[model samples]
Target: MNTPLLELQGLSVHYGSLRALGSIDLVVYPGELVTLLGSNGAGKSTTLRAISALVPAHGQILWRGGSLAGVPAHRLLKLGIGHCPEGRRVLSRQSVVENLMLGAYLRRDTAAIHTDLERCYGLFPRLAERRSQLAGALSGGEQQMLAIARALMGRPELLLLDEPDLGLAPKLVGEVMGALAQLHCEGLTLLLVEQNAEAVLEIADRGYVLEAGQLTLQGPAQELLANPSLRAAYLGG
Candidate 1:
């Protein structure tokens, strides 16, 4: 087995008195796509926030075998981790190109940033066409695409995506997943948190089930897909 790019051990989080995540252990290897699935109020989103240090968390978060203690979120971006949060939080008033440029704010390599901008445009031509348009004016699906493209501009080794398929049309969802699949094939490491279990399972190599602040189950994607209880419950069988 390959060494993990990111690892979490006994990870826990709380919001005041409410325990949002119990002790959790997770490992994400390079060039793999892993999905974290659960319904509303589960700690799915919380886990991503914890990794990015957006929320106070307790436990070990190791990246490349080093501790991530005291590493602020902005520093994490420079450390090769990019997060595309839920709700496609694009700068509504900014033009598409400007939004993308903001993602590379920490980067000093101007030539590389320009190359990445072109790469993002190549990956999502709609963004290229709407380069001058305000982010808010785009449709929901288009906005989601732009969000992902913006994150890609950071050139991260590990990408954390939260609910990329939220509120998208079926065709647009398919397009988004297909794009993710292509990125995975090109050796991108992904840790995705999504409510769309079935859709995510189709592309994930393995999955972890989060339920109300704790991981309840985990296994290969195929095995999880074949689980009768999971199908009848979370999967809408």
Candidate 2:
């Protein structure tokens, strides 16, 4: 087995008196796509936030066997971790290209940045078509694509994506999911948090289920997809 690229042990988070995440342990290996599935408010986003250091979390987050404690949120991208947060939080006023440029703000390699910019355009042709348009003017699906492309601009080793497919039509959902699958096939390690369990499970190597901030079930994607209870609760079977 390969050494894990990322690991979480007893990770927990609190928002004032409320615990947003109970202790949860999960692992993702290099070049693998792992999905974290749950309904709304299940701490799926919290998990990704904790890893990105967006929220104060307790316990361990190990990256390539090194402890991530005390690592500041802003530095995570420089450390080869990219986070595409929920809500497609693109700068509404900025042009699409400008938003993507901001994603590589920490990097000095101008040539490579340009290359990655073109790559992102390739990944989302619609983004290429609207490269000069204001991010806010794009449709929901287009904004989601921009958000993912912005994250990819960081050239991360492990990408943490939260709800990339939320609130879109079925056709848009399929388009977004297909892009993710392509990225995974190209060997990008992804830790995705999504409520669309069936779509994600189809591309995931493994999945962990979070229920009200605690893990309730976890296994290979195929097994989880095949489980009757999971099908009923999450897969809409």
Candidate 3:
């Protein structure tokens, strides 16, 4: 079997006395879109943070069959892990183009960086149209697009997306998910955390259900979508 692009074994995290995640194991293959689904306070966000090394946690995180021990979050960018965090944390004061440049901070290939900038623009034309505009000025949907594009500027092998569809209209949600599908089609591996379970399952090949920081269920997307419990709790049955 091919090696996984990202793997987490027996991962656990705590906040003070609260156990946020309890012994979770997950594996995401190269070029596959894997969705993590859960309700509020289910530890969905914490999982992403843990994998990105943004929070202190206990586990074994392996990338391409190698350990990620003591690897700082900033260093992960160069190792091809790009995180488009929740809340679309773009540089509000910077122009769209400048924010994208920040994503390539660790890159030394000037030529490829320039090429990737154009690629980002092509993927998000609205960003290109507002390349000189401050990131704060864009609409919520546009800002989300910019956030994903900025992360893509790093040319990561795996993209960790946290609630990419949060707070957007239904139509905009489709657009955002469509963009993600496009990226996956182009060979990007994705580990997505989403509360909108129905839409997420529609695009994901497989999914895991997180509840109270524990992985309660997992299966192929189609099967999970048909699950009676998932239908009642998440699919609005």
Candidate 4:
């Protein structure tokens, strides 16, 4: 078996006295798309944040057999982990192009960064159209696209996305999900967190479900999609 590209062993997170995650164990392989599914307040975002070193947490985050303990978030980005945070936190005052450029701040490869910028534009043609527009002026869906594109500009070996489909119309959700599917096909490893289980499961290789900061179920995506209880609880069967 191939070594896991990312692994969490007994991972837990606390906000003061409150536990946000409870000893969750998960693995994501290189070149695979894995989805973390859950409803609101389920620690889905906390899981991504902890892996990105954005929050204090307990246990180990292993990347390619090495522990990520005490690593700063910027260093983690340089080591090839990119995070597209929830809420489309683009720089509102900056031009769309500028936000994308910032994503490559840690890289010295000017030529490759330029190439990736163009590639991001290609992936989301609307971004190409509004490349010079201020990010705040764009619609919610467009901002989400820009957030994903910005993450792509980092050229990460493993991309961690948090709720890329939140608060968008159905059509926009399809567009965002389709772009993610394309990215995975083009050999980007993705750890996607979403409440939209049905959409993500259709594209993901494997999935893990979280409930109130604890993992409740995990399996191959299709199997989870087919499981009777899962279908009833999350899939609305």
Top candidate when judged by lDDT against the true structure: 4
lDDT of each: 0.93, 0.94, 0.93, 0.95
Off by over 4 Å in 4: none
TM-score of each: 0.97, 0.98, 0.97, 0.98
Superposed model 3: Cα runs more than 4 Å off: none
RMSD of 1: 0.9
Q: What is the lDDT of residue 217 in candidate 1?
A: 85
lDDT of 3 at 112: 99
Clashing pairs in 1: none
Error of 4 at 202 (Å): 0.4
- Per-residue error for 126 in candidate 1, Å, reads 1.1
Instruction: Please provide, for model 1 over 1-237, each residue's C-alpha lDDT reduced to its tens digit, 9 standing for 90 to 100.
Output: 788899999999999999999999999989889999898999999999999999999999999999998999889988989999999999999999999999888889999999989988888888999999999999999999999999998899999999999999999999999999989998999999988889999999999999988888899999998988778778888
Per-residue lDDT of candidate 2, residues 1-237 (tens digit): 688999999999999999999999999999999999999999999999899988999999999999999999988888889999999999999999999999888889999999999999998999999999999999999999999999999899999999999899999999999999999999999999999999999999999999999999999999999989889998778
RMSD of model 3, in Å?
Answer: 1.0
Ordering by TM-score: 4, 2, 1, 3
- Clash counts per candidate, in order, are 0, 0, 0, 0
Q: What is the lDDT of residue 207 in candidate 1?
A: 95
